[model samples]
Target: METTTATGGVDEPGWDVDPDDEIASVVEALGHQQKRWREAAGLGVAEFATAMGYGEDQVRKVERGARIPRPEYLDRADEVLGANGFISAMKEQMAKARYPKKVRELAKLEERAVELSLYSNHNIHGLLQTEEFAWALLSTWRPALSKSELERAVAARVARQSVFERSPAPELSFVQEEVTLRRPIGDTMVLRRQLERLLEVGQLSNVELQVMPTLRGNHPGTAGLIEVLKFGDGTAIGRSEGAFASRPVSSPRQLRVLELRYGIIRAQALPPGESLAFIEQVLGET
Candidate 1:
């Protein structure tokens, strides 16, 4: 009912939200539709949940994209709202969709990069994800994925670590925002395994990991997450703020801008050895 006001854009209703934006477009559409109906009916989440035979918390989570809807629930809701198979089509999109475009490019880059550097602000980088951790994160989304998509995601994610396996090995480094270490992804066991994996990988000759100190009073990377990828023969690409559109950094000025910022961030971060110790301290091993 209030969908127009919710979006507030006279020309745009909402986002197409890319069919495979990795979070599952089906689920994303479900969320949009639910919000559309709720506002149309002039009801709050709790009231709507009661009407739909579910808990208010569940409804709220769906609305906020913290959970996915079951197919049967969607069918029932669709019939009630006279949406006429809109949600059903979205379910198909969820099952058939491949990985999102951004992630797909990242997968390619992982395989191609001669050296990779990542800076994480709010969460662990995907390339470093463990199987359980990746699945746990993916399964919690609103449009649930099929088993195949899940497996593809897992394989692709694990494969990214193979950059460490190259004979020469790509030069790797990560400057993690202090908050990432504090965010407990997956369960304690999953997190512990991930940390242990980090230690193992950090020991590799080509890899370096640094933690930007939460207590450092001031830091250069406080600006945002940055990933500057260097390829063979001095070619490179860059992604930032979060993908303002992954652009080429071929020009000397662009490359210098990234290199300078990255250098400053790395300098401000703890040294690799100290960073490992800092991680251990956060893990309560120290």
Candidate 2:
């Protein structure tokens, strides 16, 4: 609910799409329609904002399409501007734009995955992150987030765990760096809770959790985080992201290479039973 503006005049916690993109165009069109309706109702930004119970700056930003308006914002704008259902009807489109584009794309990929292999060299995988742990991890992100943005991301990341509860759940495997488990990103309590969550998840029939010991010298996963998602139709795609940007690897040759490296990393990691024991030991020390 809290918001801030930077010196450049953009909302600190808002989303942005390329100006010429289709989504941007739709948002702009909606904004223009709202402005026209407000003008027809003989209301300035201040009056419209006061009627809508939002800040005047927010009113201006929404009308300029510089901010992605939530459903409630659109509904209030509709009532205050006398646009009836017209303004609020854009809710569906805005909803699709709610999450960052990259997140949406990744989420769609996850939806079709029948099995997933994940190797984390740093933080816990998003699908396995506890709410408090995710909040702690995201809060320290370099660019920083507005309170609202942070909450949105944390919710999205945690929601991904629903995959674990799916009927005929997808097979899932995770190999996390030992250091990631040891680092108390949040205080001791948060880290302990997260480790406990991992222990619970590791017990699932379709899930396997492994840990790569810090004592182990250089390994295949030292390159960064690697993820390969396998679909029911025998197709698989992968990517490794760390110092370099991520790109999908669907070509059979590339997938084979990634699979080979991932196989080696898995071999190097502690087995699931040993990994659970290690986690329990860490939890006790905590």
Score every model by TM-score.
0.60, 0.72
Q: Against the true structure, whose TM-score is highest?
A: 2
Candidate lDDT values, in order: 0.66, 0.82
Of candidate 1, the 10-residue stretch with the lowest lDDT total is: 7-16
- Candidate 1 Cα outliers beyond 4 Å, as residue runs: 1-102, 142-147, 242-249
**Superposition error at 99 for model 2 (Å):** 2.0
Against the true structure, whose lDDT is highest?
A: 2
lDDT of 2: 0.82
The residue pairs found clashing in candidate 1 are 1-40, 27-143, 68-142
Candidate 1 global lDDT: 0.66
What is the C-alpha lDDT profile of model 1 across 1-286, one tens digit per residue? Answer: 0022222311111122343356554565668877897788687776666566666555665665545554555665666566678755665344333334546567667667888878877677877777787777777666886664565566456656666777767899888887776667788887777777677777888889988878865655666778888878777877665333546455667767666778888898899999888778777741
Report the lDDT of model 1 for residue 178: 77
